[model samples]
Target: MAAAGVSLGATVLCLLAWAGLAAADRVYIHPFHLLVYSKSSCEQLEKSSAETPKALTFTPVPIQAKTSPVDEEALREQLALATEKLQEDDRMRAAKVGMMLNFLGFHMYRMLSESCSTASGTVLSPTTLFGTLASLYLGALDPTASRLQAFLGVPGEDQGCTSRLDGHKVLSALHTIQGLLVAQGGAGGQSTLLLSTVLGLFTAPGLRLKQPFVRGLAPFAPVTLPRSLDLSTDPDLAAEKINRFMQAVTGWKMDRPVSGVSPDSTLLFNTYVHFQGKLKGFSLLPGLQDFWVDNATSVSVPMISGTGTFQHWSDAQNNLSLTRVPLSKNACLLLVQPHGASDLQQVEALTFQHNFLTWLKNLSPRAIRLTMPQLTLRASYDLQDLLAQAKLPTLLGAEANLGKISEDNLRVGKVLNSILLELKADEGEQPTESAPQPDGPLEVTLSRPFLFAIYEQDSTALHFLGRVANPLSTV
Candidate 1:
């Protein structure tokens, strides 16, 4: 009986080992052969998927307001040529902001998604997060700076010097993208985008800030310093003071965001972003659109409609469809929607990769009639907590040397980032005659939970990343 039991145990162990190998075989890569991936396995999974690649059948239409210039005979060719020339501050347009956002948005999604899972709507400023990190990069020293460079995706200035990470260059690139959006009527035309960036460093008494760090922020952030308060006691008072300061800075238009303060801390880093945008040729649909909350539930909210020739893409593997509508002269609103039959969670894995934005650039130009809810989003996040969630708390922890920010032994405390985005169409606005008549137009509606991002066309970097699962929910 003991011999029989031993044999049975050995058989069970063998079976478990076989199962483990089988599971790993599906996704595992040999450490030494990292470049090699199983094409057959990937193909098998794609072929087995229920969703089919959507056909890009929508015919292209002329895209221009009545007051705007006439569409050229070679309009599509002209657009393709123009788009090819698009470059922002020496970085490729495809990865400029997409790379940074993919890094930061994942953390924000992980940290905020659960809280928003209950309410069903969440917004994050990838640009603000990027700027904050750039500021941190400016203040960090040695190993901390090296770690930050990796986090910010700064590929060093070629071979000779891998020692010092250039924070100014990274910040300037981000600012250049913003500059393209904020410029009034460049060769691209008048933009309907209004973006306000404010970066603040609130330091306790006595410690003097560095001139280099102060000047470094000028290109990236309009407001870098000039406020202080006792962070020692009374969390409520600190909140009030911060709120009041923010109000004065923003003309009292934003709501107060809650934050925690440390008694022993001497410094607080804050970044605020406010965005207001309007689609030039889009019109508001008078009725509230039905946005599906789940398989059996839905909510009603105001929706806007637009029609024009736009770039569109669909993926069968991820169960997602995407399109780009120019939000301003230089910024485009890239919208993604999962099939009504599928949940938002179905396409979520795509966000973790750079492929999400890459797919947008490869879309075929098609005529589309889109209906989406007007956007009003206000969110605040603690950068320190986000960094901790990223598993690198020590990079900006109490032990961090932020000498570039100030000469004293400053302990970096709470880092707060606040964002306000208001996206809407003009009341009683009407679409131009050139707008595609809905008869056979590719009708795309955000009547279900969908993801949206506003990216600079010149740089292709996302400024705002958000989703509207329940539009009526309080932000």
Candidate 2:
């Protein structure tokens, strides 16, 4: 995929050089003294090599975007040239996003997952997190965009005037899936699925965000807010004020808000996802069900069980089992739990895996009486911490040129992602939860910790991911 990006960038660079539209970035070609041809011959060869291409293509090339005060025209032309490539790249965008998000998800989740190792579950929305960074990429220049493009699994664009695989395209692709989930939020049953998200941009009172950057975030339904913060004078106080703002917006769904706002920071980014899943014909166990909170301890919690034909598989070598149940027209609730003596941690090490879905493609439906805990969770993270954990601490570093984000020198404040997930029974369909159990189906119970991910059926995007240890705790 990166090869495609490099090729596209190189192609555009080659075209621009041929037309004399690019001057800032150059490839110096020189014929030297000894191994090279004589000076006279070298001069003639260079002239012909440079002029031959322009001669072959009679069409006069227009000025590129970066060379002028207005960049829209250049970007549009670039997009036009890459239409075929963009279409092909768009087809694989979801898979690309999934692989990249999960890869980042695994590393990011490792730290917080372990922090909640002995507690309840931890939840996260890969799309929400990825979108925020992608938005920043919209405003970023060169090196910063270059670093983030790899993290985002997006290709590089022409510089001075850069590439056309704009951050907006990636964010829009994700928003399209989100739109599908919201539209397909099926009617009441034991499991009804609904998903929605919002982005909050809090900036220092006087800083101005770039038009393109602001426009790029419109699809994500961002709420713009300018707040007065003496960031440089008192960063800690500024952090607290921003934290309060987020708490009010999220209704305190997240704890601690986000800490460590740089003193020079002019803005902060936050996004939240709300998801509710209720399954039909799945009812609570006769009584409180016992759960193994850890290897050495156990607690009783409300549990639900249902008998049905569902896709099921296992990695016996890893003592893990996966059960996929449909939630809505465009989504499914995927459950992964440890079997026998295997711990949830081992299963955590496996969820959001690259080939896991490839393996799931071959899942054979089977009859099983599956029992899972009543789930209610809220998981939160500081995005900067995730970058640091991924060993790319320089992403939002000082050298980053985020001109599109704001005109002022901005310091990024709390980059937070908070996700809320609740599994419940539909109020109107309460009685349907009591359908007769199958006489001889296999009994599979999640009376212990387990890992889970929600998939958007159409796009096959990993919407939300987490591990549940205790049904009650909000991570």
Q: Which candidate wins on TM-score?
A: 1
Give candidate 2 misplaced runs (Cα > 4 Å). Answer: 1-103, 110-120, 157-164, 185-191, 222-226, 232-240, 250-252, 285-287, 427-439
Best by lDDT: 1
lDDT of 1 by residue, 1-475 (tens): 2332242334334323533343555685222111112355446536755475432221111111112222222222232233434454234423444455445555556566655563366777777787788778877766566566556543222222322345665665566666665544446454456777776666665556766577778766755554566667775676667666666555525554746777777777888777778865678787777877777998778788887677888777678888887665567788888875464765654653346656865788777877888887777778777666555667788777776677576888888888888888743323333444557668887787788778776555667777766777655
Q: What's each prediction's TM-score?
A: 0.73, 0.72
lDDT by residue (89-119, candidate 2, tens digit) is: 3544444454445545544556566655446
Candidate 1: segments with Cα more than 4 A from true spot: 1-119, 155-162, 184-188, 252-256, 287-289, 295-297, 352-354, 426-439
Q: Cα lDDT of all candidates, in order?
A: 0.62, 0.60
At residue 267, candidate 2 shows an lDDT of: 69
